[model samples]
Target: MSYRRTTDFLLHDWLEVSSLQSRARFADHNRETFDAVLDMCEKLAAEKFAPFNRLADTEEPWFDGEKVHLPAASHAAAKAYAESGMLAAAQDYELGGMQLPCVVEMAANSFFSKAGIGIGGGGMLTSGNANLLMAHGTPLQQQVFAANEFGGRFSGTMCLSEPQAGSSLSDVVTRAVPDGADFEAEPLGPRYRLRGNKMWISNGEHELTENIIHLVLAKIPGPDGKLVPGTRGISLFIVPKKLVGTDGQLTGERNDVALAGLNHKLGYRGIPNTLLNFGEGKFPVRGSAGAIGYLVGKSGEGLRCMFHMMNEARIAVGLGATMLGYAGYEASLAYAKDRPQGRPMGPSGKDATLPQIPIIRHADVKRMLLAQKSYCEGALALELYCARLVDEAHTGAPDDAAQAALLLEMLTPIAKSWPSEWCLEANSLAIQVHGGYGYTRDFPVEQYWRDNRLNMIHEGTHGIQALDLLGRKVVMDGGKGLQLLASRINATIERALALPDFAEQGNTLAATLAQVGAATKAAWATGNPEEALANATPYLQAFGHLVLGWIWLDVALCAQARAATLDHALLQGKLAACRFFFRHELPRVGAWLQVVTRRDDTCRTMDEAWF
Candidate 1:
């Protein structure tokens, strides 16, 4: 099957560092490297990753006695990714990677993950590991560990979750005791031993790599004989799969950590999520009954040090969620156009002799298509926007960048969870578009649904996202974060309001902004935030709906404005999508707003015993 997409599908003509301020006469930045990165991704994805998606799912990674056994195709895909220089795209150039823009990387990452999140896991972990190493590891530490030790043969895992502490890291029972081993330890790295277990670790125990570098989060006893509750008491360490010699190669000496069990998951099955016992039988190879841990930043500043990597991972999570939705939308749209189906609803007026039509011809089907298109496309726009913010955050625009970051922080949960929730719904509707046939195993849609279900549970749950939105982000820096977001969207609407067709949409968006602003004030008015937590989820959804609407309008306005210079008619489909969403979807915001303003007894009125 040929998976051909037109350039019309994408918002921009090609990858470029566009002046966000420049509406006309756009120039592509030094995208030679970016184009090379894109070419590498396209080549590897089509030639290797895409073909192995179904195969990987069919032969889901397995745990034998010692190592996790991934299919040969999966391993080959990983190798291809590494060789193509795409595995470490986010790393610094000196770190042996094709340093590319985060936005461009994200665009390519969409293709890779869409091929299979299962196959994409290894590369994701590699990038994450490289990030951790880059941020926390010292110069000598980088030389011995990142450069020489693991080198290309090593893999990394962010071992944070435990049975008792999933999101609540402060509650982790993982302990790191001081070591008096004969082995020479780094001055900058953690010079102790770790004795604890971490659960839900992806790629925890796999033979695909020569060694695994476990970034264990642990708490050592303080002077008062107790580990603190805050992040200060926590520490990060690089516990290797095998002890390395001065030359940076492994000594073939096994570390204390052992794979307890493999976690069977719904999707991303190619990467093994393992339950690990850090110090088990024959443990503490270099230390006394505890696994040796080379410290990261400071003794107690582990959480602070890890934040750099975690924030990067958060963007990755959002990016993953966005693209999976995009993939489903693209696939479903193609199917609608390609698949021949029933005729028009009209009274067979002109020609009853005519054959059946594609599903795109139907108004209701078009509604579903448009819904998916808008949701996924808005999500793409948001992710790219956030990526641009990240670029600015790194470059010259510090204050604006910081404010942009604050806005992203406020919206991150929504970015991650909204796509997971809304786009999974998109996948469901894709199945519906396929009719009963979609539910069957014959099509990929069912698998797509199964795969998408995990996205809600990944990085963090949807409820967690809602809480993140309402509980913390809303009031951060005296609500300046939210105001910053409002200003950005309002600015877009201001530009769009100049257009003829967008005047009504501009008004609708204005109304939504007002509603959201008011609801935010009401949310703040409650005396106790916990008591007011009932309004959290609805507020999240209400605000999410509005953000999406704003972004969609941005896209429509762009298309309208750019039409004169370019083949504006080519943007007909995107314009239709914007109009369809405004006409069909925007009206529902009022009801959602009612839900927000009323703040009803849905969670109230019912007793706990009723459950």
Candidate 2:
């Protein structure tokens, strides 16, 4: 088995994750269940998904004017994924789900992502869409739209971005007007005529599923028939590709949701990214002028409702980036071990018969491998940590749940952005490890790099996440979330101090935490919010490193406690990675924090005309 697929570190880290879930009332999720789910995912990913990863990239989906055509393997893999009952892994059992913990679902998801992100993206998007409906949709809405999605009979999408609006929801111009008595009303809600264009809609016009349920964000005109400004007036609607009757059966009447065109991507080519004309005259719905849709939550609460999926998608994006890095690392490691090339630097005489050693023996090659290991493994840990926190937020005691929510709020941006930035670096290192061959399609590292590159910009751009981290998350509600995070880190520090093997690691992390706190204070002390946030990106990087450092120390302590019983190499690897991160990666936080705390505005203050 590839090291990426069956890393002991995954089971090691999952120990803590499972423990947290058990304490939060998830009693059925022991190691047996977790490992079973993981094993299933691993097998399915390798057999059904990984074989077609390269194929999917090479044979990108095509639009033949009307329909998007993808490889048969894409649909097959998606059906297998949905049939595994993982689509609703965390949903309630009564809702036709497995009721698995979110962390376990995340771990299982990593395998699919490692196999192929383009294929995994369909499952992730469907899961996110279903989760959102479960969270905020009415019972009828959940039964009609989300249930079929969970059952694999249908697929779902979140449609937010527009050509003009992009990430700025305030500028969205999609309008949803009440359809009146013309359209049939169901138990879900009143129907509306949705007329707008949704750009970058994944799974927008695919034949893989029977129906496509789009969670679209649009604004309803007020009493004056004028749309409200900004996200305040935006509303979420359930727009189906095919009209469904109140009985959840197809009406054979196609909705006015027409396919505008296909947007081919550099990577993630298996899933069709599209521009959808929701209510153009191309397809009329019952002689109606616009697409038929049902409002989701309140009229003006669209952003809030969409946020459920957005946040989930952000974390999923982070996981996608992490898995891509892991895939590259595994591929490079295998190549390094098997491919014989250079001899030792000192002993390589000009003898024509000298035996060439494997590249893994080289110090520089080891350095690159270690870098990838630390980055991919650390990112995986960070994402799982966030997933466990999500479980805590949802299922823990009152105060614990509140604190967990606060801490998750503070860490979400870091969890999303940090892995994206570092894991891409890991993929680069993997490419470097393979040298020339890595750049070519003969190996998978280059494709891994390409696929991961999209993650940095999707969900929310790194810059957007950084602004949220430094400008909003850390400072909101008088920094209660930040304080809660500090308290949790301090608790870990205290626990680590009691263990002799981890005292130094804990102390180093403690010092870094203190530096982060001080830097945050100094940055905000300027009282000029704009100036303080000028170098928010650097602050985000520094803060993200601090969070990773804390998580590493926490994991190290846990590993140390289990060292006697666990595999020796696994334990040593965790400790060594922790040390490597602290010695090499953590110190960079100091320099970044300096730029942050000093309120460096050289870049921000630069005149645009100068460029």
Per-model TM-score versus the true fold: 0.91, 0.96
- Candidate that scores best on TM-score: 2
State candidate 1's TM-score. Answer: 0.91
Off by over 4 Å in 1: 1-29, 148-151, 181-188, 230-232, 282-284, 348-354, 565-570, 598-605
lDDT per model vs. reference? 0.73, 0.86
Per-residue lDDT of 75 in model 1: 80
lDDT of 2 by residue, 1-611 (tens): 34543244554444455575456346767767877888899999999999999989999889787778889999899889988999988887887877777877898888899998888688888888988988888888888888899988889998999999899989999999889874446466768999989999888888899999999999999999999987799999999999887778899989999888888788888888989988886789888679988888888999999999999888888988989999998899999999898766566554546798899998888888887888888888888878877887888889988887888889889888988999999999999989999989999999999998988888999989988998899999999989989998999999988988778878888999999999999988969989888889989999999998888887777777777776787778778888888888998988999888888889888999999
Q: Report the Cα RMSD per candidate.
A: 3.5, 2.1
In model 2, pairs of residues that clash are none
> How does residue 18 of candidate 2 score in lDDT?
56
